[model samples]
Target: MSEAVLRLSGLEKSYNRGKPNEVRVLRGVELALVPGEIVALVAPSGAGKSTLLHMAGLLDVPDAGTVEIGGREMGGLGDRARTAVRRREVGFVYQFHHLLPEFTALENITLPQLADGATERAAQARARELLSRVGLEARADHRPAALSGGEQQRVAFCRALANGPRILLADEPTGNLDPATADRLFDVLMELVADEGLSALIATHNLELAARMSRVLRLDGGALHPQA
Candidate 1:
């Protein structure tokens, strides 16, 4: 079998480690995403879904256990190494678009590629290509405020994919949109992942949308359980 693109084993995380109000977010949480797989992570509010995504994307660290991307262990890597891996190998989308208010859609997408060492011309070209893929080529010059909610989220998706990362981790990516818009955006997200052959772990509260993914897993009581 092909190796897993992203894996988590025995992950444990707690806030306020030694305090009475401490909260344990993840307890021995584990997951594996193979190439081209789309996994839906279903969890209720305050269930640590965002925390899990952060750990997977290297935005945060687990108190115990390991995060492996493309078979390389991340727990012991230095800051620079972890940052480099995050830039080149992982992509993340949150509930909010979080686009820079000043930059145009195209610019927003181009910036990450530039940060990853691509030339200006290459970055712009890549940005244009991604916008076109999402059928937003004409809105490339529009700022986030100028676009509709759905459009802004679509642009955010393009931004996450700008670096062509192998793994995509999204936290309620379409949650802010209306149901109709959410459905449409989710379709685009799935298409984008498939076209890029990316392994994705998308956390969402919508069961109808979850049913469309390759597999579904539930996060409850700080652990992961495969959905039947």
Candidate 2:
């Protein structure tokens, strides 16, 4: 069996603390993703799917519990250390493509690699390779505005992969696309995940998409429940 790449234990997060409108987003939520395993995170609207991904991705700290990646505990890590872990080990994809409008698709993917200290030549090579994998090579020089919604998201996927993260955390990655486009893009995503042997936790409302994953976990009322 593959080693666990991501693990969350007894995670808890709350907002508006000490106030009447306070919201408890995640309570004791636990999950683990093995290397090369693709797991689905299913939850309804406002159910803290984003919160869970953020916590798992190390973008935000949990009020309680632990977030671990590659067996390294995240709690108590300094900001620079946590950021280093995030940049080196995790990749994030959101509902929105969130590509830089002014940059070409190739540039968007190359930028992360550059930030990670790759040489300009090496970064561009990796960017071109990933863009080709997503069938976006032809659109490499186009800006986000010039691409279709599906193409933009495909570029986002390439950008996420440029850093070669071991784990991918996606929050409703295809939520903005039409049914046909979402399905196609998801297939590409699954292929990339399998090819790279990266573990992934993707949140989605679509049951069909959820079923395609290796395991499905539903988040409701701040807890995670496995589904048949």
Candidate 3:
């Protein structure tokens, strides 16, 4: 079997540590995602789904255990090194479309590539290509405010993939859309992931959507279990 593209081993995280009101968000969670696999993460609200995604994407540190991306241990990496690895290997989407209102769809998608050292022309070309793939080429010049919710989220998807990251960690990517829109957008998301050959861990409450992925895991009581 191919090596896992993203692995979380024995992860543990807590809030307000050592305090009377401390809350444990994760406990000994282990996960591994091989290339080109799309895994659905199902969890109740406030079940630490976001926290798990953060750890997987290197946005947060675990109190215990390690995150390995592309076989590199991330626990001991400095902030700069972690950031570099995250920029080059991880992509993230949230429950809401967080596109910058001031930037056009194309510009928003181009910004991350620029930050990663790509030239402006190259970033723009890549942005256009992704937009085209999602059928948003004509809306590239529009800002988030000018686009519908579904369109805005689609642009957000393109922006997330702009850097060609190996792993995509999404927290309720279509939670805000209506049923029909959510279903359609999810189809686009799966297509994009397949085209990019990425491994994805997407959190959602929609069972129908979860059933479409390659595997399903339930996040309950701060740990992961295979969905029966």
Candidate 4:
């Protein structure tokens, strides 16, 4: 069934408060991502794409509006509840691969599972499976410092999928890589998303990447609208 896994309505956020320097970043944003969807969000710089992404990932709360994940509204959830929801439902990827330097590739992928109290064996198995999918099984024991930029990003992808997150939010995940590398990374990302039946909302500046998604939505004047 087509159901909204991640949804936002009437979202708004502003920096500074009741002062001459105050500026509204997002003005009444609304969007949704269904299960198995790969949607692209495009916007010019300073159009509040990052801010909206932060709010959707549950890293920050909007000054107004509500964000719901897996049918649970986060508007009234307390900090403890929000953290739990974030850990259980949302996965995030940034432009820079944020793999822990000290952790082996396997360990990095399994860290979130460990945090959620999964047994070592179970987490290892999951990590191994993901590494195989990302074609990084041989790098399992290597540290981030020992891997190339593309390899590091592959590990990051594995880590993000460790918990079987319902929604994966990728903010310019390939923005740091060269064209060929970025293309390969996106291929791996889309493969995993399909294989796991995971939903995704990726914010990007690359029109070619955006065009390949199921739908492309442009954020303009504080709102999201489908782009041709």
Q: Which residue pairs overlap in candidate 4's backbone?
A: none
**Which of candidates 2 and 4 reaches a greater lDDT?**
2
Please provide, for model 3 over 123-147, each residue's C-alpha lDDT reduced to its tens digit, 9 standing for 90 to 100: 9999999999999999999999999
Q: Give all candidates' CA lDDT scores.
A: 0.96, 0.93, 0.96, 0.91
* Candidate 2 stretches greater than 4 Å from native: none
Pick by lDDT: 1 or 4, better one = 1
lDDT score at residue 132, model 3, on the 0-100 scale: 98
All candidates: CA RMSD (Å):
0.7, 0.9, 0.7, 0.9
* TM-score, per-candidate, Cα-based: 0.98, 0.98, 0.99, 0.98
Q: How many backbone clashes does candidate 3 have?
A: 0
* Residue-level error in angstroms, candidate 4, position 203: 0.8
Instruction: For residue 2, give model 2's deviation from the true position in Å.
Output: 3.9
Please give the RMSD of candidate 3 to the true structure: 0.7
Error of 1 at 3 (Å): 0.6
TM value for model 2: 0.98
Model 2: per-residue Cα lDDT over 84-199, one tens digit each: 88988999988999999999999999999888899999999999999999999999999999999999999999899889999999989999999999999999999999988899
User: Cα deviation of 187 in candidate 3 (Å)?
Assistant: 0.4
Cα-lDDT of candidate 3: 0.96
